[model samples]
Target chain A: MQEKDIFNLLTDEGFCNYCLKTNADDVEYWENWLEEHPSERENIESQKNLIILLANETAAQVTQSEYQKLQRRIQLSKKNNRKIFPLIMRWAVAASLIISLSFGYYFYHKAQNNRQIATTISNKTAPGSTKAILILANGQKIELSAAANGTIATQSNTAIRKTNDGRIIYDGDSKSLLYNTTITPRGGKFDLTLADGTKVTLDAASSIKYPVSFTGKERKVEITGQVYFEVAHNAAKPFRVLTRGQTIEVLGTHFNINAYDDEPTIKTTLLEGKVSVNYLGINALLKPGEQASVKSGVSDIRVKAVDTELVIAWKNGLFRFSKTGLRSVMRQISRWYDMEIIYPETLKNTDLFEGSTPRSANVQSILRKLEVTGHVKFKVDGNKIIILNK
Target chain B: MKKGLDYINEWDAFVQAENEAAFHELYCHYFKYLSFIALKKGFPVNKVKDNINDLFLCLWEKKGQLNNVVNFHNYIVSSFLRKLYRKENLEIDESMFVETVPGLQTYPSVESQYIAQHTQDDLSRILKIFVEKLPDKQKQMIYQKFYLGLSYKEISETNSISINTVYNTIYKALEKLKIEIGKENLSAFSLALALLSLLCLIYFQKIS
Candidate 1:
């Protein structure tokens, strides 16, 4: 580079601005210019120092009154220019609804013929009711459904209560830790509140054994069959649920565990917070709306996202099935209706049901809904349901 | 420095949503920087405040046209400078300027010299002594560029001189530093290289 060109650059207004780092464009231009003129870098840099030496004084201050005055002017200017119109949106909504209703009435009858089917059964099997046998640590049984709403028993200083809505509550602290087991038999479901204030809802044919008062560093409970729990939040004393094949550790979260003995895999579904599901040597962390399943005697714990509403439908008094096999649906029914489902050798377990019905419906109505699909028929012989493929 | 995304969103809210809150944020962000520039450019402190208001008011009026501005900081700084320089016949006394760099008044304590060794202050300290010996006009121009954070175009307009003259004066001042530092057994090449690195550091952290 010539000395005159170097001198020209040193005196250039944009170059001086670039050196002081004021104008973004000048800075970008000089940087690119420097990159291309590698040989002239030293000369160009000596000049940059002169300009850089003068940059960045602490900025002058703006008073509060100055700020408020400018803000008010900006606000007033915005209000003067803005013109609002809300009527167009309302008109658009009304017109779209009228168009939808006219199309709906035209096709209403055509769709009705194929949708409705009627069936009646002479023998009806009522759905599961709120009933459980609570056994105290000292070999005493108290029928929960038959027991009146009040404090039924006191263990160590804690009062065991039965709410009018069929929920058993264990209130107050106990000096000595004692364990109580609540078993929901076939054709029955129950709700229980542990001494730690954790709420447990046992599905049909499920059982939970918990301490009358949680002590030590953790609150631990053992469960069998399907159970939904809203564990009380206690960060210091972590809540742990022990199933047949898995141990779930949580610090206050809503989760459901399906660990029924008849099922091949133990599934733990987390609704909120975090829960760690550990089965044998395999460990899985479950986020909300995620299910962790581990098969018996298996080392791999599979984690997948599942619709939680369908998983906890039983607790909400509904039987929801989506691509669920015949065997799986019957197992849930068997627990609810106390009926044994016998699938013959010729029957295909592959028949999947995709529908939901109220759990309060009679067993025959639930079966009729499945039979209407024309894949299978049920022959009810007292408490036994013999499944025959159509 | 505030991120680019925050400025972009504030601009969008101010223009599209017509949010007064976003307008207030943008007004405050540039108020100090612009006010400093206006005052350095020879606008009296009282007039600098109102001049800043007029500049922002003009910006708000033309906000629709400014929606597609790519570099918001450059656009704002240039616009404010342009507004201040619209009139060509402002009287500014070049000799009346005082040399007071806001943050450069450190008395080199024993601990500071130890800590600032091979640091920015240490490198700048070598040039600071040389800079102070420069003639009043040259020293004030360099101070406006470095200490006061003004562009060469701003310094030219501030002194009512041509941009070329502003460059020539600064060029002469730098040549003087190169010769003076060379006499001190510090090669101009090495000192300039060190200064170049410091300039890049300042370049990246430029908030205005």
Candidate 2:
């Protein structure tokens, strides 16, 4: 093959080991071919780099309104940055360390911030893109990210189709009652409509285990990480989300759950409907625009009025932090950006950040934002970002 | 060409919140430079906006530590570059040496250089033409694979197409780029075309 043929293959995206998902045969052939022509190795590698160069160059120019939107978000963050770390904020920090739940939902600033950060992969884990893995009831795993859209699989009595906008839809009878689990990896997100028209948006490093057909008396789905659910209303059949340490029952509602194990608390925020959160032996009813916090070692769940907009901002692609601690903020960043956060003794436990930036942004952009607060400094080294003393 | 010290000094001034004007000035000054870099790097417009915005936010968040930064420009640029690379690029020095091997047809340098040096406006104009010319399905496919970096399988599932179709669509688009870069036998002619495209891009960008 000509060197250009090799170039063509390298630029083809899935032709190398870096592609992550490759045909074993193609990998074998290329492995052998490169070995035979040792000299072509250098050229092949350069071609691969050239494709990256192309990919890097493909970033679109920023628009006027988008810039203005970020400007607003920054200013708002600046306002929050000055927050005095009052009792509520401290409580939030304490709660976050124990679980993912913090009633500390930053209030909706009511500011119009439509900042959208384009996902960049050069440093750290790229922000979650539209990808999900679907595990069938039979334990057959379908890489939903790669399958053909329509009816990729028929689990039990449900037909699963990936929509053009990258949503998985379940359409069919609920007679089978077989369970299917959808999981989003560390840097992935996907929109899902369950067997009963319930819309669920799974955030990065999250999963939802739901029955393909909800045949029983109640609709139950278990979740880990953060998931924004807009449950389809049915008076006869209530939707219940079984999360770590708690169970949330809703007649029909919109809510979000942050249930990652590393978080010190479990936060479930109700947006547009009435929901009841049961944690340990205690139960708390939540009204619209309220958040329930289930703190570690605490038997009761605390419910409070919250700005639903701020709590569910991830669904809209914004990272909204209000009086959020450095650690808490970085926790969100590390999960979304898929980077390990290394802190020097200085930033390990100092400062509170307040603001909103799009999760689609490059890690550096966000890091720079934090650095300018004058309380923190950052250095991005490969996939790990080290926090240095100023 | 301001020195890194000057940039750091300005960063300090802005971080201290002693001079909002200095902050705005710094933003205006680096906005174009970063935009040019990002646009030249082929980031789309809204992202260019977000990239700059996010950097500024980072500056604000880490302002307390601005005094520690020795090279603000390199710091910012490296940070932005970090956003682009999931893995390290092969050493260019090695490739540069390999390119000089006698009779080896290095994939035309004219295109690579031209590609890397485009201004935001120039790229926007060219992409407008290029993307508009593509069939809707192909355009969507290109955006999904190149912009979103979705796997072919993800794209196939999303677009309701076969995995081969997804691969072929991207393969064809990239092939067009290869052909465009390979059209002429004479290096001088290809260089001339690249320059001509640059000129046309600049001219078209100015008018539009």
Candidate 3:
């Protein structure tokens, strides 16, 4: 390489590759190349250094705000092993561990303590079941959960039936398209397959209204409460989900929409493919492993990379929460158990719980886990729970 | 109570054990440097802040691997910056706003020496002078190449110039830079190299 052309070579692909450190082979080649051609070394060296300086200059100034945010994210991500029990309970668990320590040992102690107090003696309500009410286009209400598997109903030309696994599947293509609404009560949850092969799992107290046969360029579904969608891709057709204050559009993707009316924010977490979350006038796109949170009374949309596992834990039958407040945790419990929650009048506690238990666990078992926190106690009376100070 | 080196030494152990207190101290110690580096990588202010947390999360996930990690501070700095860049690229999602980068080249390996004596404020001050001294065309080329992390091909097409011309433009800018900064202060370029390695570290992380 000529002296003048050294700069050109440096700015070229190979030189950039070297700086970016593509491989050991590239680095070795450049080192030997420089040694062999020492005449152009000085000029090449200077240009190389300049590239480094320029790269350094790319980063802008940092702010205190930035540091604080980083700290919060780190804390959020480190929650895998967080028990979140109160300090007193934590010490008790620690002492037990010192005496008989295995991961299962501590869990065994908890299971025994919860069973002794919760499931056997306490008024117990089981978690939600595979139950839903199907409203036909003609306003006929069919209790799908009570009916045996096989052909439950035929909407237009589509056979609306339950699989062996109890999931509703729309098997046949319906030429005459009519809308059907499936609703799950407070103590129920159900999964259904749409005409376009889209699979939706509706949570308790949620409903989805969709057409028996999808037509036109867009497949539209209106939903309330929480639902998980595995949208079947139709390149020419798009899938749009409408909720209270937001609309999510996707070509074909796996996503979870938590738009429960009780929650302030409508969170749409994408697990695969792409989804566009449109709220108010703004549009925020999401990739796999990213979540778009649309808040009430706010037009601005916030996007963040999140643990997809944590977001979809409900669908997987786990009550996975991170630093969740007692109030919110109890809210979820109420929906799952078809129970009402009442708190003491003189509430002065601010402690939040930060752990998860099986959703299928009895109400007493669930409450016992919270009680172990040593912050709040639960009195399960019939289908109502009274929360009080410890 | 451990300051500087003492904190750095215990960082891995504290993180491994999920010791929030010890980790909080470490976060405060390195927060400023990491924040500055993220900004330099062309992240928006909100994202710069978010990436700081993402970096820690990424660190927490790989806490067990910290036992094998050498050059801890450099690893943290480069990874922190890289985390910001990766989040933007990887999480473009379904938003219609982002134009996906075609074949984005990753930055080099994060070597320990990447961040050195100069603070964020110091680096910014010097770079501002250098940018001010350069001509408009040279400044644009430098901005496109360095700040944007654009390839020569992309820069060429974006600017509607020949590929060689893109090289020449950057070369001329560097010549001007060496002349203006002088041979005596040549060590500054090496300092920049250390910083640039943060990008490289991110790039390597992407492939691996």
Candidate 4:
């Protein structure tokens, strides 16, 4: 084969494809044929050299600066990657913190309003239910549950009267005074009148221990859970309420205490007269229609103006929900209608609703209204309401 | 066998550590011959140096992960060629290399072809400087075809250019390099060396 022939053979499209595509068998055949052609060997040799050279030529050089820059970029990217998780975690924590804080604050204010309403309504009607342990000053224990509904017993100096309103009142002609303690339980509410004629309304899941009769420098009560007070005027003896984590000192004032153990914060609302609230080592004197809150272990006390009717709505036999979530609404429902709440996962994301319903309204009616407004559905199974997805 | 594995592991650890001295030693040991092969394939000098530097850096990054690299010289040469072809955006069908050379009437047996063996050290400082001078595009094309061993079709596909254009540009670049390097009275060995070095340099410069 001439040089021209060899070049053409190497460069021919068909031959190139065959060589590139075929196996060792085909390559061997070509190798044998080329080996047999000794006369045109040099030409074949040069063509082979050119082919080899083409194959060998492949790599390109890079500049020092460019290489250094790429290395730097890769390193920087790796470093940045490490910070991503912490940054995301911080944002998540911050967002949840804000959300929980807002929710807690809103509920605190709302509960105060509910307590106010509950007090006003509770004073007007017969108390719904109560579990109060009556302790006479002489250390005699009378379980209120076992005693008759009215006028259980009387001390020699004081008249221990149980009114139709579920209050244990002491009506004394003289200035005789005696002390007693009434402790209420979960799913229980009660009313009482002190010897000084101070009216007290206790909410469900609550307790209050006070004097049966008054003839002292100060009228004081120790309480838990929730209660509304209408203290009789006593210029000398100031009325004081001691609860978990705080104290409320009043002078001829009407107020409420919400110190439920499950509750994250303690609340005190002043309805009328002067009262000083002390919480988390901080003290604030409150006028009527003012509420104070202490959250967690923090001493940050927040006082704000409030509507008195909304705060005391619960005592009025009305279920009031103000910007309340599904969980909170269900909790209230579970208590009132005496039902178990089972919520589906999807219902957890439901929007908050604010409204009021009479306690006389059945469970189904409240659920139906909620379904209409929030686009959620519920199934009533016996005493259990299963909240479902829309 | 365990001792061999341990040695390999140690070597990998050293590479991962980015010991510049070890890389420089490896360069000195193999770059000259590698540069020669690159130049013969028609890469410019600067490109050859750049390609070598990139390879070393890559090797360092993937130190412990390196495998199937029995012949470091051939591996580098092949790797360089592949990078060049990719850089130029060439789409050479790999199957073609196994096929016969196009436009040839007769071909020599593959065994008889004088494919120069490249060493790591052959790629040195002088070759790097030489490649730096070439135009960017020319350097890239030369590296793609020669160093990367990509076919014109692969180059075209990668670079988003016509196959015909890849061929013509490579042809033009080789011719220009041959003329430029021919002026020096370098030994035939160094001439071949210069050719490879220059091809890599020119190709890299062009692409960059």
> Against the true structure, whose TM-score is highest?
3
Residue-level lDDT tens digits of model 1 in A67-162:
767667777867764643246557778988998888787677655753454233333477889999999989899999999989999998889999
Compared with the true structure, the alpha-carbon lDDT of candidate 4 equals: 0.59
- What is the C-alpha DockQ of each candidate? 0.07, 0.04, 0.07, 0.04
The positional error of residue A187 in candidate 4, measured at the CA in angstroms, is 3.6
lDDT of 3 by residue, B1-208 (tens): 2323456646855756767677666665555444333433334544655666766667767776777654465456545534554555542111110011112232221431253232354444566677766665666566556544566566666556777786677666655554554533545554434333333332332333
TM per prediction: 0.45, 0.46, 0.48, 0.41
Model 3: lDDT to the true structure: 0.68
> What are the candidates' C-alpha RMSDs?
24.1, 25.2, 21.5, 28.8
Q: Name the better of 1 and 2 by DockQ.
A: 1
Order candidates by TM-score, high to low.
3, 2, 1, 4
Candidate 2 lDDT, tens digit per residue, B77-109?
546544433223411110000001111112223
Per-residue C-alpha lDDT of model 4 across residues A123-199, encoded as one tens digit per residue? 21122355567788789887775677666777866778776655677777445556677766545566778778888
Q: Candidate 3, residues A1-390: lDDT per residue as tens digits? A: 334353343335556556545435656777777888887566556445445556544322222334456566656645634645366577988898787767588889889888867656644487788899999999999998888889988866789878898988887777776899999999788999998899999999999999998966689999999999999999798999999869999999999999999998899999999999999989998989998888887899999999888788889988865556768887899999999999999764555544446788777867765554325778988899999875
List the TM values for chain B, per candidate: 0.41, 0.39, 0.37, 0.37
- Across A1-390, the per-residue lDDT of candidate 2 in tens digits comes to 344453443444444323222245555766676898897676454443444334333422222233467579877987776785476688888878766433223222222232222223243545667888999988999887888767788765678888887789988886867888999987788899988899999999999999887889899999999999999999899888998768999988888999988888899998787898998878899888888888877897777888777788889998876557778887888888888989775453346454567888777767766654325678888889898875
Off-target runs (Cα >4 Å) in candidate 3 are A1-124, B1-208
Residue B82 displacement in candidate 4 (angstroms): 76
